[model samples]
Target: MKKLIIASVIALFILTGCNKDKDILNTLNDYNISQQDKGYHFGDKLNIPQDVLDYAEAISISFGDKETSSLSIDPKFFSLGENDVTFNIKTKSGEVLQQDATINVFAKAKARPIAYEIANQYPHDTNSFTEGFELHGDTVLESVGLDGKSKILKYTLGSRTPILEVPQPSNIFSEGITLLNDKVYQLTYKAKKGFIYDSNFKLIKEFKYPDVIAEGWGMTNDGKNLIVSDGSKNIYFLNPENPSQIVRTIAVASNTEAYDQINELEYHNGSIYANVWQKPIVLQINPANGEVTGILDFSNIAKQNTTNEDDVLNGIAFKGDNMLITGKNWSKIYEVILK
Candidate 1:
């Protein structure tokens, strides 16, 4: 009888302890973060409740690296879109507690829609799945994609046929191309290989991509360095001498949303212009910081060439003072002046 009573008392004690732990967890979970509306912006201060602040001895927050109790709202640490954050706390009892959070950052100004007028239309080969495009002087340097149909073409402006064509191997899918320092650099989609050619189309060498670039989508040169996009919000600048190395990366975003599928890049004047895959819009992105300052919508221009959804806008090139744009299997390219 004595042993039975002792065993029952021990069972009750365990149950009571479990219930107390659950109640404490519930109280902590029910604590509210003192923010209204959506989330914190660049200038907004983060508000932590007094009770919650009192719950931990030391709290550290970070999006990439944990800063020692600072607000961490520095523009360098936060992007314009959603940021996944980690919170580490050193408790009074010497226990370490880790928590996860999400904070959406907004741009300072909304991206404005840039109006444009079509100056002229030039013939483009319908057979070409336009990927990379550039206009240097009176010549057009373009790269087309597909496993067997991928190739690079050099032609004069307003011409439908290429003066020089270099076909890629049947097994590899070619992607974006950029011309820098009298050399042509071409990217492959998934093969992890890239090619460089002389100004006269002679193969100079081949190189492999680093793991940082997953899939090559668009490429252009910002005067000195070659810029590349891997179908993501991030745009990478590579060393022209060493194409395999990444020098810097910037995430593209607007006031309301983050952008991906950044295709067909072209650097003009001081900004980086790009075409988003499957969309008839071109974003004029700030190269220094990845803010999408302005947008060029070509819904009317896209309808002129689009027959199906696959033939989305995918090309951008600057000619003199005009912008030359075309799409996948687009019959004609339009030269428009951005206002």
Candidate 2:
């Protein structure tokens, strides 16, 4: 019995000695370089010169990294301030890096609207990263992001309860979603594919579309043509019959020369309603000239929902006489009736 105890102790000591700490921390390179600013907007192309990448590993930092070398892009927090973002970029060996390059974020400055007075607010499921939302009477159709977990949820207005959910295709990252003539049209992120679903949520058809639109962020229809946004400063008008042909393209107008990430879109009456990805404002755009006529500031909406994290505000639904707005990680869906 004593010999057996001694052997067990030896084995335990050897195992503990061999158990070393794992060194494989997630490197900045492990993440797809293309996805660095997926949730935010930047220039049409990075200005990173070959000389810049020659020596240092190219990394992005958000304003949250102010204390450490890490970087973050919390839209609700840093995006509210000037064009500065805070984040961190640590190396494979725990080394931190920085460029001190200043980024200019362009968020509209407007008065915060009262949560109750601005529009109707509905509690949403936090699990849903709402990308697109549309309304059929009191019924709301929503597009949730992140491939495996993404889905189309049908909910009742005012009540904010999802009554139906349709899973997306395997390996497909669902982005924008809209219904026209009883058929649902959905866009995939960077997949260059569009899916068509029937009333029963069955896959009817899958088609290829433009890849130049910068990840197919949002989609909507104007009864005659399909309008889409790509997290850029422009909106695309395409022929629903033939999406390959660009019918028209409209650049979202802002007071400044900066570009805003136009994520979700809805066509109400004759104007285009777009949700600027990380901002608290919604622009009322003129379809004819692509001019922003009115801006609805809902800063108070975020203040009321203090429990939510810094999320991407991307969902917009327009029903008959009512409008609905939701965010990527928001806990509620708001039924907004603009006064």
Runs in model 2 deviating more than 4 A are 1-116, 159-161, 306-310
Best by TM-score: 1
Model 2 alpha-carbon miss at residue 121, Å: 2.9
For candidate 2, write residues 1-339 as lDDT tens digits. Answer: 999999999999766533411111122233223333432332223334333234334345554534422234333333321244332334333445543333433334322332224456677887887877888877778888886887888887766567888887678778888888888888888788888888667888877777567678888999988898887777888887777667977666543334557888999899888888767778777787555667777677766554545475667777565667778777787777777
Question: Candidate 2 lDDT (Cα, whole model)?
Answer: 0.66
Top-lDDT structure, candidate number: 1
lDDT of each: 0.83, 0.66
Evaluate candidate 2 by giving its C-alpha RMSD to the native, one decimal.
Answer: 14.7
Which regions in candidate 1 have their CA more than 4 angstroms from the true location? Answer: 1-44, 48-51, 62-69, 89-95
